[model samples]
Structures are given as structure tokens and as C-alpha cells.
Target: MSEPEIRLQAWETHIEEFGTQQYGLSFDTLIKAVGKGPRAAHKLARRLKKSGRAHVVRIDYGSPGPWRNSKNFDEPGAAPHGPLWMFADRQIAWGYLEFDPGEWHPKASTAAHLTAVTELRLALTGLDTDPQVWTSERLLRRRLKTESGLAGIHIHDAWFQDFADPDKVWAVEVELSRKFGDGRLTRSLSAALEAAERNDLCGVLYFVRGDGLRRAVEGAATRLAHQRNLDRLPNLEIHDLDATLARKGVR
Candidate 1:
């Protein structure tokens, strides 16, 4: 068994590595990474908090609607009902709003970002079984020469593949409300293809916020597929975010 300090250091290091990239860390995810029992983990978390090493953020989802604030919290152990443990220093700097316990909700919250954290939690769960997970934030920066100029691309929200093996990894992009034009779609498809061809990824996964967004993304995927050839399009998997949130029992 790892010593308490060692375990705590693992938590800190994990936060420094990944928590700084995405939105923040979840309580459950933090515990899993620490490899400690829940109660022990909670105690460690409290210690981290007391020591100013971490913070447990409370996320409250507003009613569902078109506005970014309308997003729902559906992941298991997600807040208003539970707490999200994040590194104190990494929270606001990583795009998550500052933790204000008195406030009902954070100043900013997005379905796509939250979904990324949830997906990351799912990835952490599978660590014991085998595959190593890497998010877009963790990916090595690669300079890809586009027709216009050299575009530096790195950091995907979450990657589904083993780090040690050469197996094709899946790059995921969570889209809640952002609109993409044809040109952007073409560039995205081209980038994915380039990444795949370079043996950096096996495919791409787009987690859209709703049915409407799904239609839009699918259209782009289809268009890109038609232009790039049938085989490349199959590599893109567009999924509905709500269903995933519900499946995870976030609500």
C-alpha cells in the first residue's frame, strides 16, 4: 500500500498534470486516481483543502434550455447533490469559474466542458483494466501545415486508446453550442485525417449537446466523408450528450 503522503502526492500530481487542462476534477475521479478508499480519500481531500492544495467545488445545474446556463448536471456524484474535488490552483485558471460557496452557481458552466470532465472520469475508471487515457490538453503539440499556414494542434478533450501501444486512439471533442461553418468543418476533418494518417489517432468522436447539434455535426461529418472517401467518415462517431449524461446517472 502506498503511504498517505505518497497517495496525496499522487493526487496532487494528477491534478497538476490533467486537472489543469480540462475544467477540473471530480471527487470520485480524484479518489480513484489516489487509489484510496472513499472515506480515506475524503479525509485526504479535506486535508488537501486545509493545506490549500485542493478545493472541492460545488456545481449546480440550472434548468435545461438553449442558453449555456440551461445545461443539466446528470453525471453520478456530480453537484448540487455532490462535490467536485479540484486542485485549488488549477480551478479558475483552467476555465472553471472560481469557487464561491455562497453563490448558487458558478459564473460560468458549459455542457461540453462538463461532459469532457465526465468522459475523463469514465476514462479513469478503465485505468485498472488497461488503456491509458490522454485528453487533448495532454496530447503532444504537433505542427500541421495547412494550405493557409502552419497550425499547431494539441490537446483533445479526451482520448480513448492506450499510451504504450501503437493502437489508434480516439480523439473526442465535446460540442455544446458552438457553431461550425463549412470551412471549419473541412479543416477539422482534414486535421483528423492527418492525425490518423500520421498514426496519432484511429478516429474522432464528437459529443454534441443535443439533437439539433447532432444534426449539424453529422452533416459536416457526412460532407467531409463524401469528400474524403467513405472509409474516413466511419472514423467519426457523433453521440448525443444528454443520453450520455443520463446514462452516467449524473442527475
Candidate 2:
């Protein structure tokens, strides 16, 4: 087989072994994984799709713009795009919950979704072991039914945790375009933070898109800590997306 095919096979094996079907790899992540340039990666992906080896999902997130095929490659106005790619055989073999590619709603925020995708990519590329990615749907299923009244404690866009010990995890909340200091955000995060503290997980990491968002998250975390009567906020860490990607060795 060729080098790109070999890389594709390796990525497939990783996904199968790691059971990351729920959060399918993104176009950028696929490019990085295959160590290929944009044109080559896009060509490989198109080939994979033709061979029934991959599935794709493209969304506009309530916007009216052509999808970005690659960093600099744009899909034509007449043609649609696919940003999320999943290996078909591996997803089924791993017994992961399946969903149709067409089910992606255009109303959701793509910026937030992209942030989660970046976090997943960073964990996959940077960590020694494959991380367990938990979306809000997964967390909702894990909510307690009994009397803490914590049914709606979903504060994270995605949760990244070591598969070996899930409690040693990061509750990743993405602040893409929203003001992190919003009251609703603070209230929801306060509950989740309390739960994280009680569970003694690694910590909650707020992935903000800008300095202003970072400051807002930090300030909110501080206020929550004081309100909860904590000496120090050990369960909160805020980072900018560029810093995270840089640390993960992604350009």
C-alpha cells in the first residue's frame, strides 16, 4: 500500500482501538494524522468516501457561507462540504452509537463545535493514551436521578479524560464567541465545578478563543470559588485555543 493509505489504516486502527466514533475526526485532524498536505488529504478523503470506507458531515451553523474544505480550500457555492469524517467499518465494529451524517443541524454554533473538535484532536495527538471524549449527550445520560437535583449539570462542550481513569479528566468548556461572564454561563459552570470538586477529577479547563474570554472565565472561576467558600480554586484552568494548539504541537 502507499504511504497515505498506510497512514489512513493507522488512523482507522487508532479509532477502532480507542472507540472514538462518537467524536469523529475533523478534516484538519485527519490531515495532521495522515501527515499530508491539504490537497493530498482531501483527495484521500474523497477516495475513502467513494470506497465506502468513510462518512462525512458538513454544517454551516446557521450561517450562509460555503464550507471550508481545507485551511485555504473552500467548497464551491454549488457543492456542499464535509468537515467531520468517520471510518464506517471501524465505527460499527467498535459498537459505538451511530448517527446519520445528514442529521447535523445548521442552527447549532459551528465555532463551539470546532472548539470541541480541536480539544479532541489535541488530546488524540498529544496524550500517550487515547482520551475518552464525552459530549453533553453522554453526560446527560450519566446524570444522577436522586436528590442532589443535578440533572441539568452539563457545563462542558466536551469532556476529555484518560480512558484508564476517567475521574482524572478535564471538563472542557469552550468559550468561542459567547461572553464567559454571562450569568447563565456562570450558574451552569458553578454547578459543574462543584461536581468536579466533589468527584476529585483533574480539573475543569475552559478553552477560550480570545484574551477577553480567558479573563472572563478566570474571573468567573474566582467568584464561584469565593461563593463556594474555597480557599483556592484548584479545579479551574483557562487556556486560549492558540496556546493549546501550540502546546499540542499543531501549527
Candidate 3:
């Protein structure tokens, strides 16, 4: 393929993946995905915006800023102050993307978590066994509403298949903070393990931040295993989120 065609193909993939995310992607995240320097990535983004294939929104505290005269594209030195990018509504209308443009806006508390999830997705691309399938939480929720078998099951942050093992699907959970209280964590874990055993998934992989949260998850897993008289609760795996991102040069 010609250089221009290759670049266009990359942009198409980037835009499609951006639609999968609940919230739009940050400029830094875009740069990482495109494998380009800041200035080049910004230029390409500007072209995409000009062509009406992408939408840009300035976000402050996870809310859209005033629409008028918002900095739609970021300059190279702007660093973290850049706006987020999403597929234009036309893309959805044309049936080219599954993401609902109306759901582009995210709550302030969830912005960071969503960004972390995106980072994890990008990091997976660098692995030896790259993802064969990646279904975002938004897409998974939509499926749950229509698929009878998915009802009452734990909805993971994302579901993916490793390229090396196409038949085995895995659940991904990005836990930035403690979300469950009381016995909720254990109950939730139990449900997930049971679902995995039912052939919904081959295993669950948790990318968690903080030592306390890791210990909590481990404790819950141990309790469940002991109660069930099993050596382990499925193929459960947990990793330090920050370290994993750093190793992949995604942080």
C-alpha cells in the first residue's frame, strides 16, 4: 500500500476503536495509538475534524466546556490540556460505527477510569498474544440487554480473546479504586467465577491499582475457593495496573 493509504487505514481503525469507548479519547492516548509524535498526530486529527469524520470536545472536569470557540485540536506544547475525540454522528448514522454519539459524555468520576481502560486496551496491542477480539463495556451492556444468556451475569469492563488462544475468551476488569463494600466484592467475584465456569469465559484478568484493593480481591478469591473446595477460582489473574502500563510505555 502507498504511504497515504496506510495512514488512512490507521485513521479508520483509530476512529472505529474510539467509538467503542464510552468516553472519547484524550490527545495523549490518540498519539500512543497512532504511533506518531504530538505535532503529527495533532495535524492528522485536524484533518479528520476538517473532513467531518471526527468530533472534538473540550472537557473540563469530565464535562463539556462551552461549545463556541473551544480548542477543537491541541497544539504540540499543550500536553494534557487537549480535548477528547470521538466519531462524528454521521459515522453512526451511516452504520459505520456501533457507538452512540449521545453517550459520548461521561460523568466526572468515571472519566479517569474510562481513560485507564483505554490505556489497557492500547497496552494489549503490544503483547505477544495480541487481542483477537475486544468488546468494550458499552458494547457488552448493549448485548446483555438483547442476549438472554447474558442476563444476570457479571458484566466485565471488557471482553477479549487472545490471539494465541482463539477459542478462549477472557474478561478484563480495570479497577482504579475500591468499588464494592460489605460482602459485595465477594458476591460479585463469586458470580464472575461461576459465570466463567459456565463457559462464558476462560478466565478473568484484573488490572488493579493500589495494594489494598489487590489484597481485598485476593482475600475474596481465597474465601470462595475454600468454600467451593477448589484449589483456585478458575483462571483468575491480577496485576499491578500502573506497572503494567509502564512496562508497555502506555503511562
| Count of clashes, each model | 7, 0, 0
Query: What clash pairs does model 1 have?
Result: 74-250, 74-251, 75-250, 76-250, 136-155, 136-156, 137-155
Total clashes for model 2: 0
lDDT of 2 by residue, 187-243 (tens): 766866766666555777766777876777676777777887986587787777767
Candidate 2 vs candidate 3: the lDDT winner is 3
The full ranking of all candidates by lDDT, starting with the best, is 3, 2, 1
TM-score of each: 0.55, 0.65, 0.75
Instruction: List all candidate RMSDs to the true structure.
Output: 9.4, 6.3, 6.0
Tens-place lDDT digits, model 1, residues 1-251? 94355334654554434544343455555565455556765666666665555555544455333322212223454334334445555443433322222222222355336545555445433323222455434222221223225456534555666455646577766776746664775576566656654545777767777788788777777777778667447667787766775675442
Q: What is the clash tally of candidate 3?
A: 0
In model 2, the runs with Cα more than 4 Å from the true position are: 1-8, 15-22, 62-112, 123-151, 158-167, 180-182
- Please give the distance, in angstroms, between residue 178's alpha carbon in candidate 1 and its true position after superposition: 3.5
What is the per-residue lDDT of model 3 for residues 71-110, given as tens digits with 9 covering 90 to 100?
5555444544334654344554234334343535544566
Q: TM-score for candidate 1, please give it.
A: 0.55
Tell me model 2's lDDT, rounded to 2 decimals: 0.54
Model 3 regions more than 4 Å off: 1-23, 61-87, 98-103, 126-132, 149-153
